[model samples]
Target: MLKYGVTHRLSTTYHPQTSGQVEVSNRGLKRILERTVGENRASWSDKLDDALWAFRTAFKTPIGCTPYKLVYGKACHLPIELEHKAYWALKHCNYDLKTAGDHRKVQLNELNELRDQAYENSLIYKEKTKRLHDSKIKNSVFNIGDRVLLFNSRLKIFSGKLKTCWTGPFTIAQVFPYGIVELSSTNGPNFKVNGHRLKQYFGGDIPPMVVPDLQTFPMDQ
Candidate 1:
């Protein structure tokens, strides 16, 4: 990948949304396998190829075309369609060996253009999705000296159910761009954490509830 000028990005911990596309694809594949395997759950491995073929040939909203079409510069022919004499199949059936070979070569030559178009469509779709997501997200505004509770995300193994996951009422020491916050706690050293982990702490003493004394009077017959 380094030789081909491809850059690798690492997804942050506890944030699967960063790799949303992969997660979505995995979910789709899982659903397909669930439907195909039926009662024989262990035989899902046998249907993996069929599921993959369905996934590849199915139209993707992001790219506005099937993955197979983007790569091959033409739509994939299903077994049923080919058997039932699809237009493309019938056309190719009439063509001689040389003619069919030439047509395939033509499609291969146009594959790059098809891939470029798909890439552009994917970028546009991503931009639209980002805009929609951003519109719904309320931006967090923090300042120095503000009290905030830090979310305890590291405790994943057999944690107590009654214990609160949020750890500290740490004072914000510094607020930086792109949701980076520096926090200082009374019992711990100062540390930088993502702003998303912190929520404003409004700690104060609760007023005690008072109960009035009750007097009972005796009733005469």
Candidate 2:
């Protein structure tokens, strides 16, 4: 895949869940692996097949169906179906070629509609997630001359323990949409940063406001 221009991404870094669908799949896969492995930590590799099978057959809420059913247009007959002789298993065991062909034809005809429904469901889920995420966000607003502190998240591994987390009382040079801000330091170069990582600076000197004295002169005379 890499040779063909397909690149693999590593998670657990900044914003690990880059996409909703991929994050959901990762969570489900982890849950299945945890349950299947139980106490056998070293035998996780051996139980990988069981975890994968469970995940593929399990119903997903966003898609509103199992992955197996979506791809094959039929639910897979598990071992339990054979052991307990379920009605579906029994009926399919003696299933005639003509009936099977008709069933497959119907599935093929409805596949497009099923896929469309799944796509709509995914969009709904994404919108709900976006609303939830946006609800917790408080936008940082700054004007062109406002002084702000920028958070330092790129600390080196061997840096001193007492290093400050914030490093600037940068002047806001420009403001852009989607939390983007251009900053200029007192003695350093100007740079662009995300507004989320900046806070209003209160360390600079301020001039006192002058108030005008009120005069109550005799106006009746």
Candidate 3:
């Protein structure tokens, strides 16, 4: 990528299945593609450039600059402006070589400041998003020896609605960071599951559960 002056960045693994910004970008692109091609979805590939141009030039309030400007360090000249000369375009067209060179240098010098301002705006945007997300999250707190319910969606296909949707009254064997807990079932296997899926078991007499034999579930799942 460095050969062509491109930078490649991997997505954060914090919660890869639910990446907010990427999903938003994909949704916006899909909307653009739908509007550009209408019912002729097969022609979307042909109109890809037009769709990209629209996205690049569109003002994004989060950073207060078009994507095109951020990448090229200057505002984009639309096709119409180039062909039929807007007022600003007309004025620029009359500039001498030295004047244009000086203007270009000045713009390049200002690019750093523009990028810094955009970076600050992005940090603020992320903090607001984090707060909004955290506000909706009711964190599940579990302690060792406490009984809790385990969500049984995987077993539901065979059992149907008549059967229990939750399987546990399982004892908490261990607690981990990021809302994960180790569970043990009486005379059965021990496993780890997300705290979101487990609720405190408050119904009846708790059974003695053992966890010497561990059955680890996929962390990504």
- Ordered list by TM-score, greatest first: 1, 2, 3
Instruction: Please give the clash total of every predicted structure, in order.
Output: 0, 0, 0
Q: After aligning candidate 1 to the native by TM-score, how far in Å is the CA of 218 from where it should be?
A: 38
**Best TM-score goes to which candidate?**
1
Each candidate's lDDT (Cα)? 0.83, 0.80, 0.78
Best by lDDT: 1
Q: For residues 1-221, what per-residue lDDT tens digits would candidate 3 score against the true structure?
A: 88999965433223333477677677788899988796867998998888888988998877789888887778877768978879887766646888878888898999999999988887788788879978887876789999998776452346655767787689999987666678898898887776767888889868988769878888895
The parts of candidate 3 lying over 4 Å away from their true place are: 1-18, 91-95, 144-175, 180-221
lDDT of 1: 0.83
Q: Residue 148 in candidate 3 has what lDDT?
A: 91
Q: In candidate 1, what are the lDDT values of residues 1-221, reduced to their tens digit?
A: 88999976543365555677788899999999998997979899999999999999999988889988887788776778878888876665535888878888898998888888889998998888779967976787999999999888774779888999997789999977666788998887888887777898988688888989989888897
Task: Enumerate residue pairs that collide in model 1.
Answer: none
Model 2, span 1-221: residue lDDT tens: 86799876433223433466787887888887887786768988898888888899989898898889888877788878989989988776536888889888898899888889988997898889889977887876699999899877664778777877887788899987656788997788887877667899899667889889998898896
- Residue 19, candidate 1: C-alpha displacement in angstroms: 1.5
Error of 1 at 55 (Å): 0.5
Each model's TM-score, in the order given?
0.68, 0.65, 0.63
Better of 1 and 2 by lDDT: 1
Scored against the true structure, residue 25 in model 3 reaches a CA lDDT of: 71
Q: How should the candidates be ordered by lDDT, best one leading?
A: 1, 2, 3
